[model samples]
Target: MPTTVLVAGFRGSMGQKATAMIKRDPELELAAVYSPHLETTDPAAYDLPATTQVFNQLSAMDTPAQVWVDFSTPAGAFENAQFALEHGMTPIIGTSGLSDDQVAQLTKLAKEQHQAGLLVPNFGLSAVLLMQFAKQAAQYFPDAEIIEMHHADKKDSPSGTAVNTAKMIAAGRKQAPETVENPVETIPGARGANYEDVPIHAVRLPGYVAHEQVLFGGPGEALTIRQDSFDRESFMHGLNIAIKQVNRLKGFAVGLENVL
Candidate 1:
């Protein structure tokens, strides 16, 4: 039998893409869809399968879905994941606004419920590889900066990928690398956001889909690792990998790299 899936935020771009992928996959079943902000509960309204159940309220979501695939907003992600776990469904979260504390809370909840779930920062293989390569380089370089670019529609700044990359690099570093302090500040916030001592710059533009660069500077030269997602198709492969490996997760884990 195919694994049943409940796609939260079914009206969103990533959610729609996930729904299509699930339908195309023989091993996965689109049992239900949830979009709290949408009033229409008819699957046909969203161009979803007629047999698929539609839900607008969390309290009313009692379906046979074994997996909860979420691409909802940061505001709704935590509640959705908790609901999935409380109802004995694994959550595959693709949303990127969750803080470290929120992730920790969800991880604890997943363990208490004995459920395996994932919170992925980026579902693009190139992005995942970039993070890995950056972590590896951090050991030798130790000093680095991150720049993430996304579409103007993206709600979160700095992105989950950039923050994750910083944390990953921090974990791999042998020692804390000292940064050159600017004695005179021409601009107060010119250095960008800091995560684990690494600076992250965020850029939002109309033409961009998703792109990121990890720059490592040493005494002699600097290294740059870059990844680009020109289209949504770039993420599907890693998302598929995450879906197939969901049950193998240890509680609520972050990154598609965990499954990779």
Candidate 2:
């Protein structure tokens, strides 16, 4: 049987890409769509099957889907995930800006419901491998920093990818490493945000799609792991994998690395 999927923010770029990918895969089915902006009674209006339901809100979805794919705004991500869990649907969240407390709450909810809640920062397969490589490198060189670059329209400052990488590196270490001494800056905020003593620098520019570099330094040399996504298609492959495997994951998982 095809896995039923409800896509929130189906009109947006990532959402649209996910929708098309889901439709193409024989293992997946488009059960419904939720978009706050676009409205249409006809399913063909969004290139979906006529049988698929369109909803402006979660409450309007009369039938519960097995999976909820969220690529909406930060404000909408948490609510969509909660709604999915409450309705016994697994949520695969692609949006950022969820706080630690909010994640905890959602994880608890998923546990109670015996469903999975996934918060994926970046669904690009190469990006997931980059994070894994960074974790491996961190074991040898504990002194490291991350720089993540994204398009200017990105809502978050430090990309979730960078934050997740830092956390993963921290997890691999038995003890916290000493902080690096920085050169004095004439301007404040010159140094990037610190996550578990790891510096994260975020760059938002017009031309870049998505890029990340993790640099680790020791006494003699430094190791750098970099990955770049020139287009949105880089993410869909990993998204498809998540949609297929989420049901088997019966608790909250933070990254696509878990599925990989």
Give the best candidate by TM-score. 1
Report the poorest 10 consecutive residues by lDDT, candidate 2. 174-183
Please give the TM-score that candidate 2 achieves against the real structure.
Answer: 0.94
lDDT of 1 by residue, 56-172 (tens): 999987899998999999999999998999999999999999988889999999999999999999999988899999999999999999999999999999899999999999998
lDDT of 2 by residue, 121-151 (tens): 8999899999888888888888888999999
**Ten consecutive residues with minimal summed lDDT in candidate 1?**
180-189
What lDDT score is found at residue 235 in candidate 2? 94
On a 0 to 100 scale, what is the lDDT of residue 235 in model 1?
87
Screening candidate 2 with a backbone cut-off below 3 angstroms (N, C-alpha, C), the clashing residue pairs are none
In model 2, the runs with Cα more than 4 Å from the true position are 39-41, 180-183
| Per-model CA lDDT versus the true structure | 0.90, 0.87
